[model samples]
Target: MLEPPDADRLYAALLARDPAFDGRAWVGVATTGIFCRLTCPARKPRPENCRWFADPRAAQQAGFRPCRRCDPLAGAADGTPDAAAGGQGLARRLMAMIRADPSRRWSEADLAGLGLDPSTVRRAFRRQFGQSFLQMARGERLRESLRTLSGDRDLIEAQLDAGFDSASGFRAAFARLFGHPPHLMRGPADLAADWIDTPLGGMIAIADDAALHLLEFTDRKALPEGLRRLSALCGGRIGLGRRAVTDQLETQLDAFFAGRQPRFSVPLRLHGTGFQRRVWQQLQTIPAGQTRSYAGLAAEIGQPSATRAVARANATNRLALVVPCHRVIGADGSLTGYAGGLWRKRRLIEAERAYAG
Candidate 1:
């Protein structure tokens, strides 16, 4: 059981019906349709109808439809608020600074200066963000390295431009993250790409002329599958090959960052289970920047009650950006759980919304 303060905050979200806490807390309705979020605005159900969980994932396990008005998943998660409240909550502050500056190389001393115990900073960041602060910073820096390397910039200059203080550190980080060194990025000069900084972290763009072909978050689980499929799709000898198409896609990505509506018309080479492919196909028709509910997606697939199955398929998608999995949200209009993390999902959608203009 959570402490009184924690429980109270969850309950208050229920009482005031704030959508901000939708995915963070769920409310069970003993009587009507199903469990909902504290932010559910469909008229308060009976006290007997009210039960709560720490997150929507739990509530969904209990089989609840998002209250239509509250649309819990849309405004689902609570950011690391404990850090925001406490005096210089070191963990939170360090995370915030890192999130804001992905290219900065933060030292232990720097983190200690931020009011965090150096060791604590190391462990907590891994626990919260799935990686050490330094690990994540390196990932971000490498993204810039990849973007520059695949473009017109010289390899050595790209390494320096990405803020690598030492050649050895830069080479090591590059090899570790991208499976190759900055100078060895030789296969394709034609493949276009750019580094996209999202709230969740950074992602790489791999596309050709006329359309955006690939967009994969370096850490996304779908990455392995994408690589495998790429080999198969390109006929087994999967090596980098530069093409004019790559440059076109890079320009398209640049347009996205600049808040311009994209003009991508390239065909995406997607791979997944039949069901997942079906779901992804549906996602493509969803427009460049609109959203759909998990339930709505299931219904569209002619499996009106198989919303969970649809969500499962979505989770397994190997082609991340090309398939546009981030376009899907919870039925109640709230953002739902995304394998890539909720924050990145939100940023992707928000960024795309601007792109739709």
Candidate 2:
């Protein structure tokens, strides 16, 4: 179990009954031997008697029972009426059915046949997942195809199994998402994309058995272009599914955010030009909470005149925090271009500084 840092901040959130920390943290009270959500209505405990945990399971493992006042086990306190809950409950049931057999095409008529109002179902799912039911089904189908492609199956076989009627149709859909056709894939042909939810936001991680190929925030503008370049380098074999490296990355990210781990041990598959590879290697050599200039990095690479080139390579880096591009500030110590945004860069640098101290 990972323990979050900044006890004072978490205690402040508890005192204010902040709902933002509900699912991300739990408070275990020593006097009552019970764990409650940060938004729990019960009286706040003394700072010395309060023990913060990352999740409810951690609290339970530490021998604390759930507080009867606030059912932390049942998600956040929405306070929705029973009628709304009942509709969402049906939507959940329908989602489960689709997940059970993602290869099967589900339609609005299908929901109506099950005694559900299609429009109501659509709204409920959209409100919860930020996507309509049909879009979710399409995503599931793509995931199924990716799972099949990870095996020894041929493209045609994988496409048909994913409920696509024609190879051309499947190729178009795959290209739209990954920026390449299924046939151009290289490497192990078992690449998978995993969505990871963090305190900052949602991130997408792509990996194969050997190493992590890509890790970027979902909202990054250059994400599609990066995917295309990675596919071209790997001979176009990217897919959607989790591998050993992805699982390890998820755990390491959790630890890193919790201030429990300072460095990542998950192997990376660095696909880039020879010069870019050298620059990234040098980036890894940078210590946490430190900054370097492009000229310094270029000099370190034995090409002091290649400062502009080094900055270009840094901008092209897709591995966000892992590659430490945020550490490479301007020569004047001004924060410069970062694909994940300068605000995020500032936050990362500050977090590292705090952790180091």
Candidate 3:
């Protein structure tokens, strides 16, 4: 029932038909008595004829029908949360079950005990979250176990808390996500990995006491290998926790997404070659709401011949928003490549324009 804080921003997104707001926002056209997704293909409505709502139900309640072109209520039919509590769909009920006892190790048999088919639940969850329901349950259990790691609980205790019956099983699951076994993280931790949820998506932030080390979207394909490399370098020093720098960076990120000029003061420990560091340093100079071509960026670094290398360095940047690698585009003025996905790059560039001046 709550409107987005900035109607102007949502309206801009509607005008642009921004795909980043496709699922997160909807527009109710007062003139046409219709509500459509932000990415709807219908002709744009005038500003005075627009009303904003967080979800389709709110728009419908406000006397707007779903647009025939966009079919904004499709997510509701598919069992995705159109409302905060969500509909009484199978996926929502399963999520409620997971919340009731997150530490329980859910199995196919457990689902079958409730007269549910495993494959049916898997497909429903996969359609909604891109992962099977069991994977989601494991993630929930892992989070419960991770919370215990900050305390004095031993690894055996943590394993039991996560519902893992064997030490080896727990270690394997932990290694899969963290890139190292639990025993390798025995010493006093100097670097910590924390999850930060943003409007774009979930990001994993790794930092030491002095500076932020890495910040990348959680779903990035390179994330697992990056963590593996970091684990090899830092050895036993990194684990699940957050440092003061993490707190500072999270605060800055909040302000940035809130349409403010973020002064990213958190110290950065860039891990790259000398040439790459130079490229990244030059990238930091590209002001928000502005873009630089790979060739342009290469020229700025006194390496006009190294445009391809500049693009490679840009691709390898682990600091998501802090370094502003999203500002780089193709020389022909197209968004060529962004590790965070082009939709996010477009959204970031659009959002930064609010305070770019």
Candidate 4:
């Protein structure tokens, strides 16, 4: 057990339901004889009725049962706040449902039918994965349709399988994800694109049998352009599927997110200028849990004056965790720009704390 802040400050945090205080403090209510997280949505207790504990164990030891409303004990293992755990748990359940029936079109009504609040589901998915649950379901449907199209099946069949009533609608949805209509992407392909689910979000991995060419979050703004570049590089030979490289990458990612130092041995087909390649190579050399400034990275690449150029290269990196672009920070140690979104960057850095030497 640890000491909490002054009672007034603790009460203020409980009132505000501050996420920063999550896992760092637990509050017991005297009237109710229950303990809850500070960020619990339950009604706040009066200051006089509130008792602060630094850890859940302390609160429980003080003759307070865990509050069922907040389920404070649920987060004791990893110290995840109840609200965040709720979002992530909801997102996972939805993702599993989407995967089980990739062709089903999900909507607000469907979510409601499953006893989920539409707006709450929307916020949960967006916060956990940076996209709405509906959008993720739609993308899964599109990927299913893409597989059908690439199998040399009729385009009409593919469109119908996507749960779209019309070809135009299916084409539009497909183009939004891949930067190309279904017709254009169909055919024998040398590079395969596959979906990978991470704790943070869904990512699309593109690879040949030998090496991974790109791995990006599905919601990344640069993903479509990256796909276009890949298409051009592979002479328009890209389709929906996975190769051994993708499987290997997935395993490595599993280890990484599980708090182990992953040895990323999957061969990479880096597409960049010489200077950019040097910067990426230097990035891989950065130990997990350590960050480097653009100037520091530039100096490591023997071009100390190319800090801006280094930053640009970092932004353009197509291989997300494999290249560790999230390890690069601003000169003042700010997160700076990450193509994968700043929220994910922050999460990755926090996750890697276990790997710090």
* Maximum-TM-score candidate: 4
Best by lDDT: 4
lDDT of 2: 0.76
Candidate 2, position 301, lDDT: 90
Q: Point out the higher-scoring one by lDDT: 1 or 3.
A: 3
User: Which candidate would rank higher by lDDT, 1 or 4?
Assistant: 4
Error of 2 at 287 (Å): 1.2
- Backbone atom clashes (below 3 Å) for every candidate: 17, 7, 0, 0
Candidate 4: where are CA atoms >4 Å away? Answer: 1-88, 150-152
- Residue 345 miss distance in model 3 (angstroms): 3.0
Indicate the residue-level lDDT of 138 in model 2: 77
Using all chains and alpha carbons, the TM-scores for the candidates as numbered come to 0.52, 0.53, 0.71, 0.76
Instruction: lDDT for model 1, please.
Output: 0.60
**Candidate 4, residue 356: lDDT:** 75
Tens digit per residue, CA lDDT, model 3, 136-247: 7877776677777766789899889888889898888777777778776655787888777676655789999899999988667687778888777776578777789989
Compared with the true structure, what per-residue lDDT tens digits does model 4 show for residues 136-186?
A: 888788778756775767889888987887888988877777888867765
Cα misplacement distance, residue 256 of candidate 1 (Å): 4.8
Residue 213 displacement (Å), model 2:
1.1
| TM-score: model 3 vs. ground truth | 0.71
Error of 4 at 83 (Å): 8.1
RMSD of each: 11.2, 9.3, 5.3, 6.9
List candidate 1 segments past 4 Å from native.
Answer: 1-105, 113-133, 144-185, 188-194, 197-200, 209-211, 221-225, 235-267, 272-275, 287-290, 303-309, 318-322, 332-334, 348-357
State how far residue 327 of model 1 sits from its true place (Å): 2.9
